[model samples]
Target: MSVLIEVVTDVAADPGVVFDLELDVDMHTASLRGSGERATTGSGRRRLQLGDEVTFHARHLGLPWRMTSRVTAYDRPHRFVDEQTRGPFRSLHHEHLFAALPGGTRMTDRMSVTAPAGPLGAVVAHLVLAPYLRRLLRRRAAHVKQVAESAGGRR
Candidate 1:
């Protein structure tokens, strides 16, 4: 079974600013500092764009993990999609959406993940992975919002 998780965040910044920050590798690393997550390969310090691939290494649940994802879709200041090409999960896909509001922007993250081990995987995906991923995404969104609203983010 595939587990789907969605998180929405409102930021006091333009959609373009939020979108760029979302694709910033350095910002991503800063957001998941507790997880020790870092992009080890691909894209380097630059923002991700369509057809780009990035490999992130992190420690989660007391175990070291690595995942490589490719940016499959990009529309700039609007929507983008990244799919895991190699990872622990059988499949992983993430879509990020940005919409302009009166005062700022609304950012939405939608992720779908399928685990590897049949029924056992299905159970784990729904119970453990879903909640964990939701929390992580929320944290990331909060970080983005904070940065995007700051004066430095306007640059």
Candidate 2:
């Protein structure tokens, strides 16, 4: 069984600014309000391209989880996709889309994930992971909104 969830936020900034932030993996540490410090995977490697691997280390509920993902697809200033290489999930595919709107930009996140166990895992993920990821994205979106709009539209 597979579970998918999508979240959207209207950021008060252009897609260019927000898209840049998404590509900057290390900047994520500062994008969200709180998640502790973050370390870059390739440290000096700052290229966002297909097959680029990146790892994010963080804790949720005091339980540490390392998220390892690779850039699956990229469409400059428009859409980019990443998939989990190794993590709690059996598989995870995340697609990030950005659309330029009238006053700002509309960012959408779509995730397709397969939990470890089978039907049982799907149930647990729907009841837990789904909601959790939704909330996490919401919070992260809020931060991105602030960061993007703070500079009178830049970051």
Candidate 2: which pairs clash? none
Expressed as tens digits, the lDDT of each residue in 14-127 for candidate 1 is 889999999988898999999999895475646888888989899987899999999999999899999999999999999999998888999999999999999999999999
Lowest summed lDDT over 10 consecutive residues: which window, candidate 2? Answer: 35-44
lDDT of 2 by residue, 47-89 (tens): 4667788877777656777888888899878999999988889
- Candidates' TM-scores? 0.95, 0.89
Q: List where candidate 2 sits over 4 angstroms from the true fold.
A: 32-37
Candidate 1: C-alpha lDDT: 0.91
Assess candidate 2 and give its lDDT.
Answer: 0.80
Top of the candidates by lDDT: 1
Q: Alpha-carbon error at 23 in model 1, in Å? A: 0.4
Q: What is each predicted model's overall lDDT from 0 to 1? A: 0.91, 0.80
